[model samples]
Target: MLPLSYAIRNLLRSKSRLAQTVGGSALVVLLVMAAVAINQGMSRVLSASGSPNNVILLGTGSEESVQRSEVSENTTGIASASIPGIQEILGVRAVSGEIHFMNYISSDDGSRAQALIRGVSPAILHVHPEVRLTQGRFPAAGEVMVGRLAWRNLGLKQDRLKIGTSITLNDQTLRVVGRFAAPGTVMESEIWAAIGDIRVVAQRETISCVVIRLEDPEDFSEVDLFAKQRLDLELSALRESDYYGRLSEFFSPLRAMIWITVSLIALGAVFGGIHTLYAAFASRVREMGTLQAIGFGRTTLLLSLLQESTLACLTGTLLASTLAMLLLDGLTVPFSIGTFSIEINSTVALIGILSGLLLGIIGVIPPAIRCLKPALPTALRS
Candidate 1:
């Protein structure tokens, strides 16, 4: 059997081939890691955004999107009074009627971008306890509060949305009064304002939905029953967690598209890596024949070849992991609904390492088998 040093020395024999193998593997693994991060980030944010104890009252037939749903402005008052078992803080019910508006807003420099804006009263804080004010205070009339990561969605610099900066919505200028954080939730990318301000700017008489936090998750049955019995309100009740779960399912096609695109690109890279490995191994055919003549079995020779390839691929994996940690991890990505941060957590890192190992093993089989196929005597002559 060949020593481990022999495989290591052979890898360094041709600098260009080594570089090609490592670089190709790195690119492929990096792509896989990125795709995993995106899908996971999107899923994590959506799942974390909703709480099981909360329920959303959406207009009938508009359950898919809150931005499109329209409920009566008085629904908040009616639901708070009618719904039993709702969470109460200091004798105040946890019911928030919010207006979700998506529209173009202009920055101070006249840069325009579409943003997800939510109009809410102070009751929102009770319904969404995950939100915490990191700076200044909650938005007041004629003012707005930006989420800590909202700048990413707005396509502006962080300082541009900082306190004291102003943004224009529907030609109305609103000052940024505060910054808030809702870790791991899509709300982190939204802009919040006073409910009346949004109503005036959006020119909507109806609110988007009514969000209610219940004392117990089991209380959802009562909420559902209420929605069913209240035929005048034209309302449908859905658990907050179920709503976001549906959103995740809605984005399944997008995630599939990402995977499909990565697979096609990786297929090309794999074929190219195969050609490189074949060429690198083919050049050593006579060497392999000489080793076989010296009592080394075909299995040992194949293992040595695999060892060399796997080493190169593992090295590429390390490179990809480093790059992902530095560039992709914790980066916020904005989509139509909201923004989610890419997190290269343990699971994602493990997936990348496994991908590299698979590339190393599967990529070398055909090339190794072909290179070892020649008869001993004829191969020695070459």
Candidate 2:
């Protein structure tokens, strides 16, 4: 068998071809990683929107979004009373009536950006424990707690998020009193305030949604049935996980568009890979023949060619992954599903590696087998 060093030497001998193959594959991997990153980031943000133990009550037929839902104020009282299997801390049941609002916010310079405002009670802090105040106190009535990402993206500092610094909302100015962080969640992109304050500002008479903490996840069916049967409340219950999964439906088409585009680009790259590897093998036909004549088996020639192709693809994968981590880490891309920042995680790394190896194997096999088919005398002619 030909030693591994022989494959290395063969690849090194044709540096330009190797670079072309590697660089092409790298561009392909880069595109694939970027698409997958968007999908992964979206999944992370939407999944993180809900807690594992919580159940949500949305307006009947409000399947896509909480914003579209209308849960009546009176329903909150009935839900708390009638809903069984709710977990409690001390003596209080875990339920919160929340209002969701969106408003335009700006820097002191007047550069405007959109922010989602979640109105909640003190219990909200307990509901979403991931939220941490990095500066100032929790928002008081008439004040807001901006997320860290929101602050950074909007170019506001803690002091800039001043006690009296006001942001216009529905023609009313609301004070910014604090800043918080809820890492890796959609909450990171929002501003939070007292429910009463937002209701007054938005002129809203109804709460947006009701969230209840369940004793166990299995309690979903019971709660869901109860909520759906309550014609008086006109509400429906969704397990938090299922709610997010439904929310993921918003991104499904966008994700499909991305995968389709990636597939087309990968198709081109695969063909390019095949062409490059075939050319590389064709040019080295004499070398392969020489090796075979020297008693290197056909299997050795095949493995050597495969190793070469694999090395090129692997190099491209690493390049793409590194570029994604460094350049696109916190870069947000706007999509109809939801705006998501690219996230590069270990899972993405693994996917990229597998993608590269698959491309290599698919591209090199035909050419490698062709190289091994010719008799040594016939191969030497080339």
Candidate 3:
């Protein structure tokens, strides 16, 4: 069999063609890897936000978003009291009543986009411990706190979302008094306000949902059952983790759509890659014949060709993975997916690399088979 160096030299012999094939293949691989990574990252962010020790109370049929649920203040209080095994800290149960809304905002240029607005209380800080007041203080009644992703992505600076900055929400001006950060969850894309104040401003007499922390994670089912048994409250409870899991299910169709679309595109790229390999091999018919003319057998020629394709593909894979890491690492994109945050972790890189190599192997098979089929004389004539 020819040394691997021989295959390397052969690729270098046609530098332009090698560059084109590798570059094109790498671009395709990079896009696919990025989409997959984003999907995985979003799933991770959603999963991480859920805690088995916490239970979420929402109106029935409101599985994904608390905003869709409307539970009266009295109902929230009763449900909070009814849930067994709830932990009380500093005389207050580890529960937070919240409200949610979205509004369109304009930058200096008047470019507008939707921004998430959540109404939270002091308990928000406890319920979502991952949240931190990075550059400002916690919001008080009638004061709003913007998240880091919102600030970063929308260019809503501390001054823009800080104390005394007025933002129009539902035609009512509200003050921005604080800015917070929740590293990877959907919460990072939101601006928070005092729940009671938001309710007053939005004319909402009821809260969206209530989040409760339990004394023990194992008590979640019991608390859920307790809430369920109290039908007068018209409330249901789920572990915070399970709540987010169900929310993640809401985005599964979108994820599936991306996967299906990418799979079809990958199929086309694979065919293109096969065609390129076939052409590359066809050009080297005489070289294969020369090897066959010598002691080298058809199997050696086939193996060598496969090795070349594999090497090319592996190189493309490495290139794609490296680019994704460098470019998409820690990118905070707003997805409709649960807690939409894209994280390009090591797993994503590995999958990207493996996908490239697999595509390469599949692409080279037909071309490699052609070499084994043609006799030495026929290859020489071609």
Top model number, lDDT: 1
For model 3, residues 36-153, the per-residue Cα lDDT tens digits are 8878877887887787788888888776677788877776577566767778877777778888766576543345566767888888776777888886678777567777677555
Off by over 4 Å in 2: 151-165, 328-343
TM-score comparison, 1 vs 3, better candidate = 1
The C-alpha lDDT values of all candidates are: 0.93, 0.78, 0.76
- Tell me how many residue pairs clash in candidate 3: 2
If both were scored by lDDT, which would come out higher, candidate 1 or candidate 2?
1
lDDT of 1 at 310: 94
For model 3, how big is the CA root-mean-square deviation? 2.3
Q: How does candidate 3 fare on TM-score?
A: 0.92
lDDT tens string, model 2, 1-382? 5667876777787889888878888888888888888888888878877777888898888856887788898776787788788887778888888988876776454656666788888777655667898888787787787776665444455445555577767666668778777777777767788999888976889988988888887887877888868988888888787788877886789899999999999999899878877877887788888888888888877887888788878988888888878887778754332346787778777888898898888989988887778888999887
As a whole number from 0 to 100, the lDDT of residue 359 in candidate 1 is 91
Q: Which residue segments of model 3 deviate by more than 4 Å?
A: 105-111, 152-159, 162-164, 337-340
Candidate with the larger TM-score of 2 and 3: 3
